[model samples]
Target: MMLTCIAVDDEPLALRLIANFIEQTPFLQLVGSYSSAAAALRGLQQQTTAVDVLFLDIQMPDLNGLELARVLDKGPGTDKPRVVFTTAFNQYALEGYKVDALDYLLKPFDYAEFRRVADKALAYANATRPTAAEPALLPQEDYLYLKVEYQLVRVDFRDILYIEGLKDYVKVYRQSEARPLLSLSSLKSLEERLPARQFMRIHRSFIIALNQVKSVSRSTVQIGSATIPVSDRHREAFDQFLSRWK
Candidate 1:
């Protein structure tokens, strides 16, 4: 798939360089290029088509790239663009990952380095791309496979007590196991794959099995020994689900 992209840099040369690189890349299509993060934000808001990727420079005078990434990360829209931080400084690398940036391109980077991160961004975009086809609910399918340590581990849905999201990874708590299954994946992706009738996202960082919830105490849910918080965003839906149970 051809991924649409935008570049945001305070420097005219840097912005032009990224734009040129994007044009040279076969899979990437440069939709917009801006001299500031604010202008890029406005362009993103006003654009007709959803931007799939963002090539952002970390340092800027107004609305720095990191702050812009955070704003887009919490956006109400589900089709949030993937971020690739471009900066001369290496210190912002850790912070960029916190916002779930797909890659980081250091300043003075060669075309080869740019292409490598671009390829990674394209793969990520395609993997998380939404499809018109609805997922089938296979009731008899009790287990799901997760790639862990380069191996696919089978995890039974009935054994799952709750899921705790840790940035790009998730810890799946099980009934019988002492240690939770850790895997490299986003909570949103897993939530979409699981059967919605049996599982519900109670918080931005938690998803619990309806059958495993022992009790609900105000804004918290009790499942086994763990207490998961139900944020205000998800509380109303949880309350409605409880009402249906009654």
Candidate 2:
């Protein structure tokens, strides 16, 4: 079966790029493309049937990717389409998975990576129709890959100091480097998949490795100059995570 897909991005060029990529994939049927999350919502509402996949962009003007994903989640029943988050920014992956996206795509992604994610989405979509239960989402082993400018780089969890989400992107602050590396995975996705015994979500935008955390303040937690915020939602959990270290 073909995977029904849609592209939702604020930038016209971004939308075009995804559209072109989708067209090249044999199993993906470009069911719809929208320049805004609002338009995608309208299309979802007007169309009685469900879509197989969504290539959702996170940084739209009014209705951002996260909001759109949340809206799509409340379907008529449990059976619904898969989501593939597409964004230039990397921090939203954690938030993206909370809505259960099939995969995350960074901007300027090559065709090979596109096919990899598209195939996973196809499998997830097809899995729904089988006799067995929905497959348990698995976590990655060894390391995670990130798209940086023109190259694909591997980042081991041990090297990270903290991660901060910006719009659709994530800034991975490292222990050895002065600069933070940007990646396509969201803070939410990282929070879920990353070994929680090692990492802590201290804020909505920040996730820090428990061993890497040097000190804590009323407003922030520090790892070098990378001061991660402590938000109300994460405060209690972070406190508990820290207590284990104490």
Overall lDDT per candidate, in order of appearance: 0.85, 0.77
Q: Give lDDT tens digits, candidate 1, residues 49-84.
A: 989999999889979999999999988887889888
Q: What is the model-wide C-alpha lDDT for candidate 1?
A: 0.85
How well does candidate 2 match the true structure in TM-score terms?
Answer: 0.53
Off by over 4 Å in 1: 131-162, 165-169, 173-193, 196-246
TM-score of each: 0.65, 0.53
Best model number under TM-score: 1
Superposition error at 227 for model 2 (Å): 41
Q: Worst 10-residue stretch by lDDT in candidate 1? A: 131-140
